[model samples]
Target: MFRVDIREMLVEAQPQMIITNDNLNARVDAQVYLKVRADEDNVKASVYNVANYKLQIVNLARTTLRNIIGTLTLKSANSERGRINEELRHTLLSETASWGIEILRTELKEIDPPEDVQITMNKVVKAENEKVAAVDFATATETQADGQRRAEIKKAEGTKQARILEAEGQALAIQLVNEAAEKYFIGNAQVLRKLEAVERALVQNAKVVIPADTQLINVIGELAGVAPIPLVPKAAASPPDRK
Candidate 1:
């Protein structure tokens, strides 16, 4: 009885230097999963159609990867990894159709560029990040300035409104005083004028003299709502007593 292991196997394509379509060299590695068909006819073919199928598959994988990589630039090889993996598996499946092997899946492990290329790519990424940060900072500054401007405008508007209200209140108070004076002091303007003169004299501490024949006493009596006193004339000395 002969024994053949009809199970899935894993193969690692060792990292090797390959020239890309753009003449740039890169180190590439991959992994492939494959299995032998379990049917009797295909099982026989797995043993007889190819000797040492594992080693043959490895060599085939290397050659296929070189060909595929040769067709792509280094940048494309790094960016379009999924496309490369799919293409590798499809090619393997087609080449091994008669070998009773199934190409299950393939994965690219690494696609490393040269040192100088790597440095250039890193610098590019850093520059892009810095540009984005600068733009964000400028936008934030502009927003803050706009907010301050609006706040100042609001403050100024509030001050203007307050001033307007105060002026209106003062004008209303003056109008009310004038109205009260007009209602109460219709024919009493002379009385008010005399009162004002007295007030100014009192404030200045001035000495004031009133003539005996003036109606000042009567005016004062009227303002105070008091009866006027009658001034009696003295008879001429009783004619010297008619001695």
Candidate 2:
């Protein structure tokens, strides 16, 4: 193992390296992960006039690693991630030369949710789906019932109209028949009077007459109550004497 002057290394601040027990740059080829955050950015450390130079690197490396861990844990917070946590690994990389540390790779690992939260999320999804289905069923039933009611009302109204029309037709037919009979009677009154006069003349001239009531006698009592008698020429009695 070679010796390293702490003051020279700190002032030069050259290539970054790692040290394990009493060895300066023993495993500089090997790199470790560092997660430093906002508060720890640009940290500079120099050992006092001191013990083994390798031991100094080792001690400083240990302290640096500890500080890195604390910073990562604080920023990560395990409950909610902060911007400090996201930049932690990168922030530490910039300090590599000053701190004499090499960071191999920073892993921002896969995000995982707690198992109980996942179960609760699934239950919420199921409840929402059931609500949607129930709403659909209720809406369909309401629409169907409303349609049926409308159809029934229309049918009833149609039946009532048909009955009314039939009754009106019957009444109109009866009225027409009665009107025809009354007009026939009123218009034939003059013809009826002429027939009655002829009938009375025939009854007076008849050799015999049959009356529905045999006991009753009908006579022309006076010329004053009667219309003027028609003039009839007497048959010549003298013509019989010539025979």
Candidate 3:
């Protein structure tokens, strides 16, 4: 009895140089999992429809990679690895359909640029990280400065309000004192003014002339708590002259 091996198989595409859409040379590799369907018609097709199918698969994988990756830049190929693997599997499945081959899964392994290109990319990534860090630091610093400025403004406003309240309080106190003085000491203020004038005149040793009937004498006597004495009339001299 003739037997055909109809089992799942692993095919690893070796690393190969490819030119990307941006004209950069990169080495790429991948792995494809496949199996031949075990039905009678698929078995016959797998036996008769293709010769040395493994080699055909390897070459097809290589050519398919070139066709797929050629449309992408090196950066895109590196970033979209899953997409590349899916596309590769789909293409292989369509091309090997007549051979009764079933594509199970595919995985893109690596896409490596030149050593100098890798170095440059690393440096670019480092610079980008540093730039982001610097922007964050500047934003944090500006935010802190803004907070401090707002706090200072609030503090100054509070101090100004406190001073304004204090000044208003002082003005109110002065108004209250003036109202009390006007209510209770209205006449006393005039009396005190005259008293102050007299005191200044006396202190300067100035001589002051005053008539006997002047009210100043009564004012001095009242301040000293003394009553004035009334004079008695002389009636006896007129009676002696008449006799």
Candidate 4:
């Protein structure tokens, strides 16, 4: 007696076809797992058609792939592989029922577009990344500028506050000196100030010029508690008229 092994088998198909949405040609490689039913009623059908069943499945898969992939653009076709696989598996399972074959699963191995399209996609990605980098750089520059502006404002405010404090300190010092002089000198503050000025002038070894006034001399001598020095008189000249 001859025996048939009804275990599942793997099938791979790489179909190169045109897409219906974009009219671009691409290659789609897929994998499928299938097996014949081991029941007695289906065993006869399996025995009669099992040898040619794989070829028929391959043709059906190619047709289904073209139909599914044709409806999608290159980008969508590349992205929606699972949808393609599911659609292909369902169609294959339904059509292969009479042949006593069961489709277990289907998968898309690869989807490759034309070289020119791939290059365009790469350029698009590069441009998008560059745009993002530019935006980030602008944001960072704006943030830095804002921070520096705030720092400068703070520094100016600090300097203004320091100046105000220094002015107040100087004003307070002048007030204290005025109060001390008023308390100690009483009515003699003016005379004491004049003496201080004269003392400062004398300390510099400056020549002193006294005015020819007896009252001023007497006032100074009275302030110093001494007798006034008498001024010498100049003699009259009469002999120049005779020449």
lDDT against the true structure, per candidate, is 0.85, 0.43, 0.84, 0.80
TM-score order of candidates, top first: 3, 1, 4, 2
**1-243, model 4: which lDDT tens digit per residue?**
546568999987656655657887687778889987888767667667556787888888888888888889888987888888899999998888888878999988877878898898899999999999999999999999999999999999999999999999999988985775575556766655754565577789887665655654565566568988787788887576664
* Residue-pair clashes per candidate: 0, 0, 0, 1
Among all candidates shown, the one with the greatest lDDT: 1
Report lDDT (Cα) of residue 15, candidate 2.
29
Residue-wise lDDT of candidate 2 within 1-243, one digit each (tens)?
322332212211122333322222211111224322222232222122333333434344444433333443321323333342334445545545454433334332222233564467579879999999999999999999999999999999999999999999999987984574365435655543543464576778854443332111211212125433344678977555563
User: What ranking emerges by lDDT with the best candidate at the front?
Assistant: 1, 3, 4, 2
Q: Cα RMSD to native, each candidate?
A: 6.6, 21.1, 10.5, 10.3
Give stretches of model 4 more than 4 Å off: 1-3, 49-51, 178-243
TM-score: the better of candidates 1 and 3: 3
Instruction: Give the total clashing residue pairs for model 4.
Output: 1
* lDDT string, candidate 1, 2-30, tens digits: 57888899988788999999998899998
Alpha-carbon shift of residue 221 in model 3 (angstroms): 25
lDDT of 3 by residue, 1-243 (tens): 547778899988888999999998999998888888999898888878999777788889999999999999999999999899889989999999899779899888889998998999999999999999999999999999999999999999999999999999999988985775575447667644554476577789997543353344555456558765444667775455664
C-alpha positional error of residue 170 in candidate 2 after TM-score superposition, expressed in Å: 1.7
> Candidate 1: lDDT of 205?
96
Model 2: number of clashes?
A: 0
lDDT of 2 at 98: 53
Which TM-score value belongs to model 4?
0.68
